[model samples]
Target: MKPKNIGIQMTDKALLFINGVPPENLPDTINYSLIACSDGAFHYLKEKGFPLEKLDFISGDFDSHSGKDETIYHEKFIFTPDQNKTDFEKSLEIIKERGYKEVDVYGGSGGEMDHFLGNLTVAFIFKDDLKITFFDDHSHYFFAPNILVLNDVKNKLISLYPFPKAENITTKGLKWSLIKENLEITNRIGTRNFAQENSVTIEFDTGNLVVFIGN
Candidate 1:
C-alpha cells in the first residue's frame, strides 16, 4: 500500500526517480500530478516497460543519454549540465519551478554510499521549501517537522536521527519514549527504536529530525 502521509497526499504532489538503486515496485503514477526522472534513471523505467508517455519531464546533464534515446525523448528532456549541482537537486529545482511543493522520491538510496549521503544532504537543503520523502526497499524516511504524527506504525522499526542536533524532544507511543530530551550527532542519537502503538507522535522544539519508518 502507498504510505499515507499528509506530505505525500498534498495537492500537486510529484514523483521523481533519480540515479541510484531502482525501487523494487513502481508506485501508481496516476496518483501524482507529475512524474519525472533523471537521465540515468530513465533507462531503468524504459527497461521496466513503464509507459514513457506518462512521464512529464526527464532532467539531468544527459551525459549518458545519447543517440537513439536522446532523439526519442529530446522534447521531454530538461538539459541541466550544471556541474555544481547533482541531477537530483536539479530535478527538485525544476519541480519547485513548476510550483510543486511535495515530491516522493524513488532510487534515492542504495548503490554508492557517498551518493546516498549526498542525496540526504540535498533533502536537508530543501527541507523547508519542499516536503520530500524517500522510499527504498527497506524503509521510507523524511525530515520531520516540529509536530509530527504517524499512523499505522505499530511495532514498526522507527528511527529518529538528528540530522545534526535536536532539542526538547517529546514522543508518545514509542517503546522507549523520549521526554524533552536532546539528540546530537556528535553526542547521542536515536536509532533502532520501535513503535509501541499504532499511532506515534513526535514533537521537537528545534533542529532537524529525520524520521525513518521501516517498511
Candidate 2:
C-alpha cells in the first residue's frame, strides 16, 4: 500500500524550545506520527495536548525514554538496543519503509552537536528518495545537488554551503551570480545571497550543497 502523506513529528532528547521557529500556522489536525527520542519530549508533547492516538509509533533506546510517561506510550513503541544508529535515523527508516516521500522534522536542532549533525546526515542519505527538511521555528534546511528552483517568498534569507569539493555553480535572480564560478568549502561566495525577483534558480555542476532558507 502507498504510504499516506502525514505530519511526521520527531522530538529530540534535548531542545531549547524556541518560540516562533515553527510557524503558528502549522496545521493542527495533522495526519501526524510522533517519534519520541527521549522521555522528556514525550512528556512535552503530552503537556502540549497533542493526542496520544496521533502517535503512530515511537522508537529509541530506553536510555532517553525511561520515565513514568514511558509506560503511558509503551503500547506503540519499538525499542532498538543497537547503538549503531541514532533514534532519528531509525525513525526515518520507518518512514521510508512506509513509503513516505516527504518529511518535516521538528525538534531536530538545539540538541547535542553529534545528534544535530546526525540528523543533517539523514538528509544526505535519503535525499534521492525523499524531500527531507529539518525545521526549527527559525529556519528550514535541505540539500540540493542539481537545479534548484525557489518560489516567490519575501523577506527570506537563502544561503548555500558547498561540501568538501569545489563546485561550479550559477544563480539567476539573485544579488550575485556565480556564472560558472568554482565554490570551495572554505569560500564564502555562496553565503547570504537573496532573491531579487519572484523566483530564484540555482544550478550546481558538482559537490553536495546545503540550501538554508530562513527569515
Candidate 3:
C-alpha cells in the first residue's frame, strides 16, 4: 500500500537526520533545505556546538529539553508524547509526512546497543515505502526487501540479516551466490558476503532483510 497522498511524495532529494552518533562525513552545512534532530539530539548538538540555527525541527518527546533552552521551537516543538515509538521513528514519520522520498539517517550507532538496533529496525518498519539508509562510521545500511541492484559496489563487503524469514533468495555479482536459499531469523544466516561485480543483484520471493554494505 502507498502512503496517503502519494501525489505529494515529490523530490528525490534526501533529508538528513541527526539521531544516534552521526558519522564524521556529516558536514557543517548539511546542504539540505531543512534538517531534523531528535529531542535529546537537540541537546546533544547544542552541547557539541552544532550551529543550532541550521536545525529546522527538533522532534520527539519534549522531556529532553533542559535548562536555558536555546531554540524557541521547544516552546512549540513537534512534541510526540507517545512512548511506544522510538524518537527516531517519530522523526521518520514527520519526514514521510512532509513528502520526502528518502531519508539519510545518522547517529544510530556507536552508542547504546539497544539504540543502534532500534534505529536499524526503523528501516524495516518503512522498508516498503521509504528509501531509508542508516549511516555508521563504517558502512551504509539498507533495510529494504526489494529488487536489489547496487552499482559501483563491486568487491565491497556486504552482509544480510533477516527480520523473521526471507525465502527463495537468489543473488548475482556476489563473491558467494545463493541459488535458492532460506535466510531466516534462526539458523542459515547471511553475513560477511562480498559483491563480485560493479552491479550486484539480489532477488527474494518473500520477506524483508537488512543489507549492510561497507563504505
Candidate 2 off by > 4 Å: 1-40, 64-71
- Write the candidate numbers in order of decreasing lDDT: 1, 3, 2
Clashing pairs in 2: 21-137, 21-138, 22-137
TM-score of each: 0.94, 0.77, 0.83
Tens digits of per-residue lDDT for model 2, 26-141? 33433433333332345556556656555666666667555665677778777766778666677777777766676666666664676667667766888887777767766778
What is the per-residue lDDT of model 3 for residues 22-77, given as tens digits with 9 covering 90 to 100?
56656434335456788777766776777776666778766656555735555436
Report per-prediction Cα RMSD to one decimal: 4.5, 5.6, 5.2
Candidate of highest lDDT: 1
Worst lDDT 10-window in candidate 1: 1-10
Comparing 1 and 3 on lDDT, the stronger one: 1
lDDT of 1 at 139: 98
Candidate 1 residue-wise lDDT, 80-186, digit = tens:
99999999999999999888889999999999999999999999999889999999999999999999999999999999999999999999999999999999999
Distance from true location, Cα of 154 in model 1, Å: 0.4
Candidate lDDT scores, in order, read 0.92, 0.63, 0.74
